[model samples]
Target chain A: MTVVMKMKDIFDCKLLMVDDEPELRKMVNEILRREGFVKIISASNCNEARQIFIHEKPDGVILDVSLPDGDGFSLLSEIRTTSAVPVLFLSARDEDENRLLGLGLGADDYITKPFLPRELTLRLRAVLSRAYFPVILKRTEKPIFRLGKTKIDLNSGAVITKNDQLMLTAKEFALLEKLYENRGNIVTGDSLCRAAWSDNLYGYENTLMVHIRRLREKIEPEPSTPRYLLTVRGLGYKLTGVEDR
Target chain B: MKNLMKILTRYVLSAAGVALILLVVNFAALITWTTQSGKTVRKNYDIAQIADSLLRSDGGYTLPETARNKIETNRQWAMLIDNNSGTVIWSLNQPSEVPQSYTVSDVAGFTRWYLNGYPVTVWKHPDGLFVLGNEKDSVWKYCVTEPMAIMDNAGVWIIIILILNSLVAVLLALLFGLRLFRSLKPLAKGIEDMAEKRPVELSTCGLLGDLAAGINDTSAQLKRQEAALSKRDNARTTWIAGISHDIRTPLSIVMGYSNQLEEDAELPQSKREQAGIIRRQSERIKTLVSDLSLASKLEYDMQPIRRSEIALAALLRQTAVDFLNSGLSDSYDLDVIIKEDAQNAMISGDEELLRRAVSNLIANCIQHNPNGCAIKVTLEKTLGNCSLTVSDNGVGFKQEMLDDLNHPKNSARLENHGLGLTIVRQIIKAHGGITKFYNLAEGGCTVVLSLP
Candidate 1:
């Protein structure tokens, strides 16, 4: 069982960023500040980073691969000796070998330089949340969803409307669960078939359409002109989130 | 090895031809010598006709004046012996030391061989035996005789000897041919190895020693050139990597600051829009730098491909979905249609690179059409190969760009399309696939990527 975490708790976590460039460190500091991260400490080299990391005991770390005094991989190994703190590598090396090496050395994520500010903040937040507040990330795995007035209980394969209850077959439940997972985003017919039939969408194209129709009839207010369950023509289908309508 | 056999065959044929020419020359010389010697002997006179000219008269045997004159002018002698008396009945110009009479055994001996020291010719006449003698040491005569049975089988003997001679000639040819083949085999192999870029070292100690040495030198020179070329390529790749790496930090700073300013609510709308443009251009620069580095790495085979089995249908669907979900505008629409047969089409490739290739094609369509376009990506399995087609209904490709793509060696105008399409071609080529680009007649372009 996992509990939901408040946004304030995420902003309260401490983050340590280590890079060789001072300007990059300052820019990242500013970016994090704007993203509502209250605690962020920085170091310019490996020695300073090690000192800060040992004394400050930060909840997460963002490290660069190259530094003046030493490289980040060895520093990561050194840090791993005493702690399980989430470490994300931010470096200019975008080669696959470097990415694999960083991840192979127990990094939580590898983000190349010149990245979008939002992407960096989001990755940093995810790493921190995974490390200190994993229960909050797991809370969204609940097996229940609401589509308009119809309520879906995935665990029991039941659709409860205002006055009556309906049941979904195993295949229908699988398809609904896949669509619900990517709610408000397009879920391709191929992906849905793989989820529902545990096979490809070759011979199951019409079978998938029939199942989607039955699923919409159970979950939507108007089955013919569906509001929640929708089709993105030539692509696949999209299920709207509960708050969309 | 095939060349070795050709050389051996030529050597054998030449050797046989030389032997045959020698045999024909010797036969021709023998015939000429025999005919000339016969003509010289005939120029002297027909010795047997002298007896016919000797006519008997009332006086002692009278010789014809012509015959007497011929025998005397030739510095020769003539005589006749009586069969009853066994004595010389008539003689003319006979040497004084020569016997004028002969017994039966003596006559037989002189007729077959010689009279004393003189070589003579004898002919039988109705009157007696006639003899003609030449000067000593002027001619040589010998008698040859064979049994009838041996003479009768001479044709068979000549044919047998001819066959035996031919067999020996062929045998000798084969022996010399094999020796020549031994000397040349290694050199032929060396040349072949050099052609294939393999190191070659041949022994320089035979009839073909100079040629072998030349081949070895060429191979060594090629090896040196190859090493130098690889070194240059390595330097180029490293330079690109260094430049791209060095630019990343400053670019990150610029992008970060510009993004912050663009989202700042206190700024004026126009100012924020200007900041947004700056951020977007900076993002474009970031893409350019990465693409430049990737293109270099791929060109030099420096990028390691991580291969895995990929279902192309699912991959295409996921790519289209990601684009749509990432906020593709209403003006532009993207669609993915996977053929039923292609839904199970699987390939072994680097998933990331292939995904990037697909993404580049779609991005190409979006980049070319600012006013919006409809992009359709389709996947199908044809003849055991996976064929992916990305077509767009928009401003089609420029004719120059299509020409540049068709002839990649002169791809000077590839910069107009950016490195996106070029990198796509490189990635697909690396995976042993072909990329084709053409404009649709309906005012758009289509790119077909076929992977085996």
Candidate 2:
């Protein structure tokens, strides 16, 4: 059974935002509210953030690096001592050191200031879902991709059709796994070769082509025209399904 | 140290020259004094010739007219003494105070030295001894004798003495030259310190003390100027960082609200389009702020690079794929070509900075060609260097822009071209790489980044 995370469930998650600026807090709260989140709490300083964090037990956090009383890094450390809630740092400090430090301190994501509202919401939702929904992330491990009439099960390394069932070699399975992961996007030939050979694509160009042909024969309904598996000229190969862009 | 050696050599040479001049002058003076004395003796009568001219005639000795004339003209006297009797046998032009006769010892003393206070020269005669004497107190004479061995080796002795004198001159020159070098050594070190921007302090209590003082003053001035320049650079970088930081929150507000307005269903299409423009411009401001801060940081070496080994072909492919997946419009297309041999090419660099460099190249191509363009990114490994080329089939760069990029000091024109290529150059330079910008012949512009 395919288990899907409901948008309502994602909206129901509680979020805590800690920032020194009042307008930024209000704006973030408004943005989250517009994105269908209902329970959004805010703290203007480290002390207030600590108090709210302990009392409300927020499911996710949007933190700023510089707070009035103390910085968010220590606050995150304090939060981590008691909880594993997802924390994303939103700050005006765009330096790489600050970002790395924030992420090193167990932040789920770091978004610099002057970010688009859509980007902010999307990152916040991703962090929330990652922390709360393990099954949705695990679904990728046992994914089933369809190429026309063929059904490829990545977990079992099986390609089943109406006429017969075929098994994929270990190398072919690794190659298809990479292509399926970037299903609608172009995956370069070098990336595919590395996936199959665990090495560079220097001497494996012809071998990659042969493996790709074999893969097409098994999965593509018309291997000659390659309806499912397509090659982007001079770039790479792109795997597409009936539903993919 | 080489300069000190030169000084010593010049000093020794000049010292040797002075010694040579002194020797030449002394030799010339000796020659002149010897010649003058010899001429004076010759002007007097020759004693041996006078003795030979004396002959017994008519029971008396007679002197020749030439000898008589020589003695008269010089106011000198001549005489001849008998060997057995020790008597004055023949005399001419003799002073009245002269003794008429002499014992053998007296004859020996007067003939060898003086007679009656007259300087005399004696020569052996056939009959007895011959004597020629100047007037009383008219000349002074002394006699000297030496062993034959010393006289025979006189040339060797002279040469040894000359060599010793030269050695002493050279030794003294070296001593003085060493003193001067010691005094100037600190000044040389001080100049080196000044060149390296280190503090310079020299002792000012020697022959070169005034020079040391001047160098110290110059170093102080240079240090002050250096400090002032660094202070100004820091202020520039800090001010840019502060302004960029301050602008972020307000820009974020504008961007967030405009983005919301752009997506609001209640807004009219035209209003939404205006909101979109505002949002887009705010985004541009955001990028500009970051770019300004980054450029300032790079200029001041404030940006620390976090280096790691990166696969060149993989990075190029990933960047192209990201641009394509990020909704690069249908108007634009990008192709990544990795040479077969270059597939394994790797370089050590800061991945984020390199990615930014590549992204800026692609963005520059797109920004300049608003209508649309095809960007080709090719990676190749040549002579152990990874070469990445980004080219576009659109309007090539203007000649002015190319000139600005080629000579970055013409930064005034770069303001129009933006900091995109400047940052690329800086990033590549930081990684020990080079960047080239040129217009392709087939109506396109290409930027090639070569990294070792």
Best prediction by lDDT? 1
lDDT of 1 at A205: 76
Docking outcome class, model 2: medium
What TM-score does chain B alone reach in each candidate, compared with the true chain B?
0.94, 0.84
Q: Best TM-score goes to which candidate?
A: 1
Tens-digit lDDT track of model 1 for B1-452 = 99789877887778777777777688789999999989998987887778888878885788788888889898899888888888888888889989867789998887788888899988887778888899998888889999999999999986787667666787899998898888888988998999999999999997899999999999999999999999998998889988988998899988888888999999999999999999999988999889988888888888888899898987898898899899888899887887877877889999999999999999999989989999999999888889999999999888977887766873212395579988988899999999999999988999999999
Best by DockQ: 1
Taken over the whole model, the C-alpha lDDT of each candidate is: 0.86, 0.84
Q: Model 2 segments beyond 4 Å from truth?
A: A1-8, A96-103, A135-141, A193-207, A242-245, B21-29, B36-78, B82-85, B89-98, B102-118, B123-129, B135-152, B203-217, B327-343, B371-385, B410-414
The TM-score measured for candidate 2 stands at 0.87
TM-score of 1: 0.93
Tens-place lDDT per residue, model 2, A67-110, is: 87888888889999998888998878667345555357888888
lDDT of 1 by residue, A107-156 (tens): 88878888889989889888877876777557655577778678888768
